[model samples]
Target: MTDLDYFDQFDDEGTEDSASKRDSLPDWVSNSNSSLAAYQAIQSLYKEKMQYIRGHSKKSHYTKKGSYHISKSEVARAAGLAKPNAIFHSVDYASKLTKELNDKNALLVASKEKILLSRSSSIKDLSKKELQSELRGRDRYKEISELKADEIVDLTLKRLPLDVKRQLYLA
Candidate 1:
């Protein structure tokens, strides 16, 4: 049968409620199907409706439980940002967070490059005292690097949702 034949079959066997599409399928299919074809066959409707609601390209990839699958409307509703007559749009928080990430990325690159260049260059050429002094400098650099890494980690932890922070404390 042609593709249209299968389309007609789905339209006939379908339930009226919309959430039954394949994206919400149990994980067993993902491991067992071996075909990687659930989204096209079952979840396509949710993807299509979601795309139409949000203007996603018709051909965009939709992964199950993956990064692209995040639903802003659902998250917003859960966060209690949904209004009886409106949708919440919070830009400042995301913008500030993006700037922070960009800053961290740039700083980490600079730090890594500095450390690599300092360590990778030959140390054999230095006199004993100079070599010892350079070793001290390397120790200092390593300490600073650890501090910077800690700073990054602590900042990341600060951004964790409240429950995660509480669990971290209990652990």
Candidate 2:
């Protein structure tokens, strides 16, 4: 569909519900008989929607379950797809993403530890403002935290940029 046609699908009067604004399934997804494809499509749609909402509102789409978190299953239900089993291939993909995220956080933690350890004696001589200024800026911190760790590693290794390698402390 054309851009104008796609935009016209939304109600401008603020009378329609948000669900009405979401685009309908394309022909391939709508006509597919494969449950796996349908499930994947649903997951893709949820990922896109979550990204959009979080980008605008600075909010997460996760629902906390004790120490764990999960997304709502309404996206799958709306797409008429059965939720995949927890042990399915998609679970592995999710686990990998989570692991990468954790690894990235761990790297940041290690970086902080290294800085603190190296500056232990001199840190007391530095003021809070000086220390803050020495660290990565707020925007850069947010950008790095929001990035997918695997993607960051992939780009760094693929491009082999000297500055990036130095910043990441890659040998």
Candidate 3:
């Protein structure tokens, strides 16, 4: 077959697959004549996009941006709607979904910030030796924590003056 014909065959197959997907949709979505179905589709698409943003799904077509929030246009395109404004046809439903999406995005940002803060605080608490070991790709924290009390006492005493060591042992 010619190159054009070959590509056209794939295009036709894609349409058929999409048609099958449409047929598989629930009755409320596939058979409805109302705009509610469109809103439902948009809501579901938004949720799917959020799943991609949250790294819960492997199939991601959306570009990675600094903001985690999904736009109305993105949802409309995912739902195969002609215009982004179509998502807002049902104002109440659209507003509710938008609020929920914003809340979820805020929570995700907050959680990430909390994780970064915890990591920074833990790093700051590390001793110079532990930090150097960590930079050398060694996990010193576990080894240090696992050190025996007697070993720690010996290590501490080894740094003291002879008189101090003698006095400490006498006491």
Candidate 4:
């Protein structure tokens, strides 16, 4: 038979067929989508653990030599699962779980960035004294809080480091 016929044999079997036969997005993309959905569900169910994972996962890049893809092992680690251990024996199941956990980590990072943005915006609404207090820590805020409003305004109006002034809402 021709080369085309030989390749078509696998296509008929529905095993490692070409992209034209299956159509739609790649398997990795579909898998990542399911993984992301599963991770969101888990995050809602296990908020505390997910938070811990998010905090600890900052250093883990999961990139390969030529690609930026995160590895399944790294994902599983972030999910608090041990490799070659319980709850992930089957290859297919392990892969699915890894994708879910990795996607969840991505979501965690995104949410953190969003929270920071919202917090900065909210800070702008604070009064000068309140902003100064926030920037200088609670102890400093307590001292400033006891001062008269005019005194606080004077302190805020004084020339200060740009960052401190910005934090105090004077900039």
Highest-lDDT candidate: 3
Winner on TM-score between 1 and 4 is 4
For model 2, residues 1-119, the per-residue Cα lDDT tens digits are 99999989986777756455334433233223443443444455545544433333211222222112223244344445466343223543444433433444354344434444454
Per-model TM-score on C-alpha atoms: 0.20, 0.21, 0.35, 0.28
Which regions of candidate 2 fall more than 4 Å away from where they truly are?
Answer: 1-92, 120-171
As for TM-score, the candidate ahead, 2 or 4, is 4
38-58: candidate 1 lDDT, tens digit per residue: 222223434434444343221
Q: Which ranges in model 3 have alpha carbons more than 4 Å from their true place?
A: 1-38, 46-68, 89-94, 100-154, 159-171
**Arrange candidates by lDDT, highest first: which order?**
3, 4, 2, 1
Q: For residues 24-53, what per-residue lDDT tens digits would candidate 4 score against the true structure?
A: 432543333334333434545346534544
Q: Regarding lDDT, does 2 or 3 come out ahead?
A: 3
Query: Higher lDDT: candidate 3 or 4?
Result: 3
lDDT of each: 0.44, 0.47, 0.57, 0.52
- As for lDDT, the candidate ahead, 1 or 3, is 3
RMSD of each: 24.1, 19.9, 11.1, 16.3
> In candidate 2, how many clashes are counted?
0
Deviation of model 3 at 142, angstroms: 11
Clashing pairs in 3: none
Q: Which ranges in model 1 have alpha carbons more than 4 Å from their true place?
A: 1-91, 120-171
What residue pairs are clashing in model 4?
none
Clash list (residue pairs), candidate 1:
22-42, 22-43
